[model samples]
Target: MTAKVENRDFTADLNNKSSKAFQDFEREFKQQMAELYQSITSYRGVEIHSLRNGSVIVNYTVLLEVPATATANSTVQGISAELVTIVNSYLNCCQSNPACGLCFNASFTEVTSAKADSVDEDLCDGQVPEGFEDYYSPALTALGVLCVTVCDKRAASPYRCVHGTCSVERSGPRCECSERAAFWYLDGSCASRLSKLGVAVGVPVAALAVAAAAFAAFLLRARRQNLEYR
Candidate 1:
């Protein structure tokens, strides 16, 4: 999760160059790092460090604190595997696309693998594949948001229900009810049809009560009139 950029000589006159170039580089670098940070943080959650020697290091440390209920040991392994897939995918895209403007092609080669459970471990271990920068720069920038999305979804670990709905497996995969059905939560389960049935029965019973009360009142008024006539 860590990326290091060594000092590149923009020109011989590091001090004389228009402070503008340095400023621009700094701005762009920070922006890129921010994007990377956002992507990883959404997945494993992370800590970032920038060294004065022109090195940027990212640590995926948040996985350690995941609640036991939210994610188990198997889920952690799955998350780690998925992160490696995403990072490799980003690296591949950057290596293939030259116009991405990500200058550190060499750095892509250094990121080899990632471990979500261990904060101190180097995910890539400075062994990125060849041509990773050219393919991964634009890919990483464009799909960085997706990395977070996929990670979040995976953390939830929803599955396609048999009925074509999305269901999350807490204890086990359970169906997500369609909104078209009358929905209710009962006894740790969702009951979808009860609301409609309840309404159907309640409306008729209410009408019967009103009609019976009106009939009794009418009968009482008729008897009182006959007594008055007598």
Candidate 2:
């Protein structure tokens, strides 16, 4: 991340304080990296160049390492999402210390390397985890670090949905079946049609049974009237 000092007039302070500033910077940077990987680590390399508009450009690599919980896809996405805040907090460490007052604008980029190579968008076979409920964050996908899922690449197309549309959602692939017709399972099978057919057959059979009962009652009444006349 880059931090541009807000005040341009503090050149003397810039020269005098830069050494101590960056020393503290390095400490904080290493600390954040350790928190991530649980080991003492710093950036792989850094390059500092002065800008014409009283800004210092610091280019650095995060020096990726395999995390202990590297298999957790959410953790992978988290590091990618939170690294900027980590760097910014490091730059703004002076904020917590009013005696060393300075403000900076932070900007950074993510480099996909190391353990992030295993980021599967169809993680856990596309089953949504608890609490998240059908909403997988698009952070890894947006970062371009995604190992695209089968559905994502349309490899799972020609979907099983006979009467529905299939879509690749943030939660993974989904089927939206037409409710006006028979109910469709989430997996896109029209199994509900059989149930509807059963109900349709049952209605006529029930009506015929009722009609036969009424006719038997009518015949019994006629026989009683005939006996009365006799």
Q: Best by TM-score, which number?
A: 2
Cα miss at 154, model 2 (Å)? 12
TM-score of 1: 0.25
lDDT of 1 by residue, 76-177 (tens): 565555444444344422434544534343433233344333222222223334432121111112212111111123322323333224433324445555
Cα-based RMSD of candidate 1: 17.9
TM-score per model over all chains? 0.25, 0.27
Cα lDDT tens digits, model 2, 189-208, are: 43344445656888999999
Model 1 — which ten-residue stretch has the worst lDDT?
133-142
Q: Number of backbone collisions per candidate, in order?
A: 23, 0
Clashing pairs in 2: none
lDDT agreement with native, every candidate: 0.41, 0.46
Where model 2 places Cα greater than 4 Å from the true spot, the runs are 1-191, 195-204, 220-230
* Residue 45's lDDT in candidate 1: 41
Error of 2 at 53 (Å): 33
